[model samples]
Target: MSRKKRIAIIGTAGIPARYGGFETLAEQLVRQLGDKYAITVYCPGPKYTKEERKTSFQSARLKYLPLQANGLQSIPYDSLSILHALFSADVLLVLGVAGAWLLPFVKLFTRKKIIVSIDGIEWKRAKWNRLAKCYLWWAEKMAVKYSHADISDNESIQDYTAVRYTSLSHIIEYGADHTVQVTPTAKDKEEYPFLHKPYAFKVCRIEPENNIHLVLEAFATMPGYTLVMIGNWKNSEYGSSLYLQYSGYNNIILMDPVYDQRKLDVIRGNAYLYVHGHSAGGTNPSLVEAMYLGLPVLAFDVSYNRTTTEGKACYFKTAADIAAIIGNTRLAVLRENGFRMKEIAHRRYTWEVVARKYDELVQRVLNNKGKIPVTPSVATIPAEQLISYELAHLQAPTPFYEKR
Candidate 1:
């Protein structure tokens, strides 16, 4: 590119990140590549707070709008950001699939390049009802079709998009550098009683896709094994129900959401076993962070999880499977697996490396080098058959998708 690409990054929650993957990615991008790219980040404005009156934040051009992030408001918030960004910026690197409806209009009106990441198979999340799933599916399709370059954060996501859209996706995942091993302070020992115990650790949003119920169930039954799980238990009925169900168990410990990195890292880094029970999406933030910290992984037996562990860590599909591993898997075996997990993290999942990949993709998108393959002839299948197959595929059917 001739000069620093003026980039307008949309679809993330906000900067000075204390939330999830997209926010962390934004924060890291500004630190690593801000000098090379002029960035404008869209933030959700205070519709309800005393501090909501404050507009901009930090070094980047912060554009705040009156919309709550991460829900139904995500559509309008991202739509507003994309529409506003079309006025300036050389490239629009939209980080999620929320505002894909405006993508065609952006292309028709301007020569600005667009890059989108349909963040993990979002529609498959169990929190969404059937109607929301349909919208997310459409948005995912549009994001792939309209963007100058589409990113798949994991190899499984890359494979899924390639098979469905016949478009090769650029793979760039969230990095796991935030968690680190910490020698416990005297104050830390005073607060957390479980710091001395041989405990299993997990932290995630309380959702069905995350399989919090399963993890809790397995830990509840086990007598000697101590399990500590962290999440927002007040967010939903499901979370509240799970909390009520498992709160009395002797072996299980449930903590509310904690954003303090030093405290959270101490908890995560000191665990004997890291239990990950996520059933949907690509590479998960918590799972990868545990891997980075050299914790032995006992992940759910999903293809995405399997791929992330590189076929080394132990996998479980049921409560019985989790229990069996917990009872039988030795510390020596786990340490060896943990060593391999750490090696994998070092090789491919660092922020500096992820930042470099994003920068390269941004340059490619701006240069018009990320091209889609030629569309193929439509398959000679009946409409009824197509609908039936699509329905089955959405649930559980044969390999409905092929690598295109």
Candidate 2:
């Protein structure tokens, strides 16, 4: 048999997927594609201690670098990974735009194919400073332009990139199959008394863009509706202050990040409703995992969230909107919505489906020469010719999207 193609995964916080979406995606990719390809994953050395670190994970080779995989350090972390992967890997699968500044050089200097997944519109987030935002904005541009192929996790993001860069971005969303519907144990219920009651649940990073305060404020007004929210409460000043303000309310339970998957799933999967306050990012893993557990979602009214749930789940723009939605929505209607969400998740969000898409992209990039735009073939035809054929509508430059 011929040798398998070598693949390098970069820009994640290291696998075994303890962190967030990108790391989960990397783990799933390795699990799904390891047999078909010779895979190597670049990991953050600082996260794993010498005793915890292994030379290999699953069937993929693991290479660790002494740098953090996020924040300002991510630039050098990802850059070094890319430079090292260039020597042996057949394709470089980068998960973010952090190291994108080096892509143009890679494109010009090397024959290796680069596939980048811009992890949402990072620069648009409220947490980033002006300088970080500026750099990320420029880096996102570079990643889209220089990479052989680019992936978008949501349709709205795909539309954004198509309009901005005039390139077709492959839509490959996160999988929720790893998140199981856990039946809370006696100990679980003892620790989380909210398990006995019909409560709304939410889990995400404690960031301004997530609209955590808005969700808390909404729940605070409706004392009857209990809301249990889990996040990194001490990670920032904003999070700490919110925790102080909201924790006093008997109806709202503010807790720190729950890294234990089983415990987290016990609380999350049993909730009557999933409140998604995120106003940024595309196809959030937390939201999809909730859907997979057949939980009805009350999400922030944004294009990304709307597209992810296919407009089937209820949405809210403000604290009043959230309170109004929860107050008026009946349990029967919520149950039906939960069914629809589970159906959508089963059909669209699974590791098998996501992995197959990545494999297909790898195959296509290996054979293809350059990026292709989403612009219709008819757009290439002259205006006079289109007028003659009475196909002017087909040649229109704008793509129609549902107003958010």
Candidate 3:
């Protein structure tokens, strides 16, 4: 009889997917791949009590660590998970760069395969302090350089790793099929009075990088539209200040975090438009979820957002930009954009497709003795060959092209 390959999924809040993107992805991976592999997931002890902790969740073993899965504690938390996996797991599917400092020892000492997904450029988020950012920056490099195989959730992130580490990163985005477009029931309407009105909606971490203040300012200035935004307003002083500042506006609704999936979906799916203010991260789960819900997105102007929407959605860089867009854009045009966004999501962001990609990559890495071939950098390509492929408009001899 053949034995199943043991896979350890590390660096998530844990399995029932109560938290964010990593948790959801981890849960979906187990559901999709558990039949073929012997899987175990590590959960944060702080989030789940002793009674809540289970031996297994959805056919995968659950191991709890007595520390937080995020913040400064994550460094040691992930290190412990990696050390434990070293004994029994054949493959360590690490989800972030928090434990990257230990990967060198794991690679040098063991035959275990390390597959990492850096989960966007964590060091660049404005929420992190200078010291935290510096550690994350070093960790990000180590994660890529030491992994057997690496993944980037967006092409923009892939380009970054390609340029910085000169490594080939597999692109695998988050799935949105789990987000259902729901209709509000009478009880739901009673609880959320805004459901009866036409309104714009947003849900994200209330961080400076997400441009939450800018979104709030836009809606506050434009009284013609009602905006409902849900987030962890009490998490930081910045969030609390913004919530207090914007809470007074009759047209603006500052909501607390909503964890129930159906409740969130019902509010999100019924929006007239979805406002995505995130300026960092690759393939944001909220933006894609909004797309899957057939909501027109008005996103912050960033390369990552453009790549996710394929340059099809409305964009804004400032409060005035957002206000102008909302005030001027016609409803029919917005709905048309929503249709295009949904079509793109349905074709690419399903969990089945994402799982298949991960399965193929895992199998290929195992077959090759847990090593992925390094791809050549674009700088090595001949200049004349690059010039030959230029478009007609860009073919004209200029200072930029003269080197060729």
Question: Which candidate ranks first by lDDT, i.e. highest?
Answer: 2
**Per-residue lDDT value at 87 in model 3:** 92
Q: Candidate 3, residues 1-404: lDDT per residue as tens digits?
A: 38999899999999899979999999999999999889999999989878998989888999999999999899999999999999979889999999999999998988888999999999988778999999999999899989889999988887788767766788899899999989999999999999999999999988889999999999989887999999999999999999889999999999999999999999999999999998889999999999998899999999899989999999999999999999999999999999999999998999999999989878877776444334533444666766777633343324211224
Location of the lowest summed lDDT over 10 successive residues in candidate 3: 394-403
In candidate 3, how many Å is residue 166 off? 0.9
State the lDDT of candidate 2 residue by residue for 194-303, as single tens digits: 89989999999999989999999999999999999999999899999999998999999988888999999999999999999999899999999999999999999999
> Could you tell me which 10 consecutive residues in candidate 1 have the lowest summed lDDT?
392-401
- lDDT accuracy of residue 346 in candidate 2: 96
lDDT of each: 0.85, 0.93, 0.90
Candidate 1 lDDT over 230-271, as tens digits, reads: 999999999999999998988899999998998999998999
RMSD of 2: 1.5
Order of candidates by TM-score, top first?
A: 2, 3, 1
Model 2 bad stretches (over 4 Å): 387-404
Off by over 4 Å in 3: 369-404
